[model samples]
Target: MTHGGGGALYLLLILILVSIPVTLIWLFHGQGNARKRRAIGFSQIAIFAIAIILFFSGVSYLQNIGFVAGFIVLIAMLITPVVFKNRV
Candidate 1:
């Protein structure tokens, strides 16, 4: 819960890691669907914010693991569309 420079940097890294794949998805599949992409992006941002808040708010270890597992599943789902573009 230290609000130091390191904490800010950690958050920035988390934001970047979460945003990169979403940005790629936005650039590719979101070609004509601006509104949809915007909504998806906002939701991702919100999810990341919630995860960080939970992390800093002294959430239990099991809950944190569950959150991370859910995040990984979400990322996998997002990547699936890109990987199998024709099917999606």
Candidate 2:
């Protein structure tokens, strides 16, 4: 049940789809403190970059846990503030 190259493509698409709107909202909506917003943005980008690096660095888990599961967790991290805005 492995998607191989196609799984990577799907993960990239999901990141793009989720990132665009989230970035726009963060950039335009003044959702929180400027520093926190930027922090979250940088963290998301860093996580994504790490995932990419791991995938290309011959990491075996990339084919199994890197794409779908990783991206979903990444997306969740990206939007966690919004999901629990009142608490944060």
Candidate 3:
């Protein structure tokens, strides 16, 4: 089986779209714990990078669906600290 280059582009676009909001929250969460938020954000970015790589290489069974799942997880991760406020 083979995948097309378009798949990688789509995944990268989606990744950017999903990351923008999370980045804004990360930037503007004035009361948030800097160290905690930074760590969480970094880890999620790393996961996203891996997801994109796996999708691009066509070696993982997850395919584009993995990126979708990653986006959902990123959204959830972003929301958690916002809701918790002081604890984050």
Number of the top TM-score candidate: 2
Model 3 ranges with Cα > 4 A deviation: 1-15, 24-29, 60-65, 77-81
Best-matching candidate per lDDT: 3
Please give the lDDT score at residue 66 for candidate 2. 52
Candidate with more favorable, higher lDDT: 1 or 2: 2
Model 2, range 4-87, lDDT digits (tens) per residue?
566567767777677757755664465556666667666666766666566555556764455555576567656765764543
Q: Candidate 1 residues 1-88, lDDT tens each? A: 3345345445455645765676556645565555655655556556655665655556567445545644654565366446544422
Ranking by TM-score: 2, 3, 1
RMSD (Å) of each candidate, 1 decimal? 6.1, 3.5, 4.2
State TM-scores per candidate: 0.48, 0.60, 0.58
Error of 3 at 73 (Å): 3.4
lDDT for each residue of candidate 3 in 12-68, tens digit (9 for 90 to 100): 576578665766576456466787777776666677677656655655566656656
- Report clashes for each candidate as comma-separated counts: 0, 0, 0
Q: Can you rank all candidates by lDDT, best first?
A: 3, 2, 1
Q: What is the lDDT of residue 85 in candidate 3?
A: 67
